[model samples]
Target: MTIDTQSQRAEHSPLRRIFGSVFAILQTRLELIGIELAEEKDRLLGVLFLGLDAMMLATMALIALTALVAIAFWDTYRWQSLAGITVVYAIAALVCALKARNGLVNSPIVFEATLAEFEKDREIFRKP
Candidate 1:
């Protein structure tokens, strides 16, 4: 009679099983987090755009009022000084807008995290 040496198989170590379960949970959580982040990013972009539009409309209103007021007080204070102040305000607004634009274009942590989540999900689903 031959010995049934091949009948028994080694079980996965407890540590290995725990690690695998932890990894799977972490990956699933990360994917959920990524989707949330993407949604948040979209929301942020929408708010930013709305704010920019409002700012532009307000600036235009202010400029029109300034023009009317300057015309009314043309004989008292120099129009040149009023124009100079408007120029300064415009410059400041420009600088702030540029900084905001830069922040939007450069920050990619949200997108990166979303991409990583997608990759993990893909790997998980691809397994046969």
Candidate 2:
């Protein structure tokens, strides 16, 4: 009579099966999260560079146009036009700076949604 030891050894314990399944799920989720992060980073970087380039080019164009305008009116109102532009831009800068300062000072808390979810989880866990 032959012993059936091979079949017993081939069968996985329940704990091992559960642990393996959990590990596989965690690994897959982590891989998916990593892929999503990479995609988001790539997209943000592309947008940032494109926006910066466009803004820089626009600023240069504006400066050139301002110079052209001043040149066109050089004989009559060159200094006056420059002075008017300077005052307008200075006021705009001051307003923008004040708004930025206020925004930085009064910004809401970061990760608000995550904090809310964490509180909910804590409440659920605390209930038993």
Candidate 3:
């Protein structure tokens, strides 16, 4: 009787290779996701810290500057100067709001690369 070990081994090789490649692709995708998550976390933390610092410092400066201006021009331009500052602040706030809105509208959704990869996979698997 002939032992048919070579054909038996050959029959399984392609299946084993396919599984191995799938696992490798999955691992690479997961690693990409992890890297993106870390970057987003860092960006969020930095924004929070910077925003908090800006708010606190700005509050103190605005109060002190307003008092100084009103006191310095107690009789002549107190109201005018205060009104001007208010207008400037309002304009700044509006500009910031618009910029934030635009930023959100333009930003890419999360896992964009992974989604693209999955779509490519789907197309590949669908081909005859």
Judging by TM-score against the true structure, name the best candidate: 3
Models 1 onward score TM values of 0.52, 0.56, 0.71
> Per-residue CA lDDT of candidate 1, range 73-114, in tens?
789876775877689788988998899999889975656665
**Which candidate wins on lDDT?**
3
lDDT value, residue 73 of candidate 3: 82
1 versus 2: better TM-score goes to: 2
> lDDT value for candidate 3?
0.86
Candidate 1 TM-score versus the reference: 0.52
Cα distance off (Å), candidate 3, residue 50: 2.1
Model 2 bad stretches (over 4 Å): 1-12, 87-128
| Candidate 3 similarity to native, TM-score | 0.71
List the lowest-lDDT window of 10 residues for candidate 3. 1-10
Give the clashing residue pairs of candidate 1, or none.
none
Q: Which lDDT tens digits does candidate 3 get at residues 1-128?
A: 13578887789999999899889888988898898889888988998899889989988998898888879888998889899888987898899789989988998788788878878877987999
What is the alpha-carbon lDDT for the whole of candidate 1? 0.77
Clashing residue pairs in candidate 2 are: none
- Against the reference, the lDDT scores of all candidates come to 0.77, 0.73, 0.86
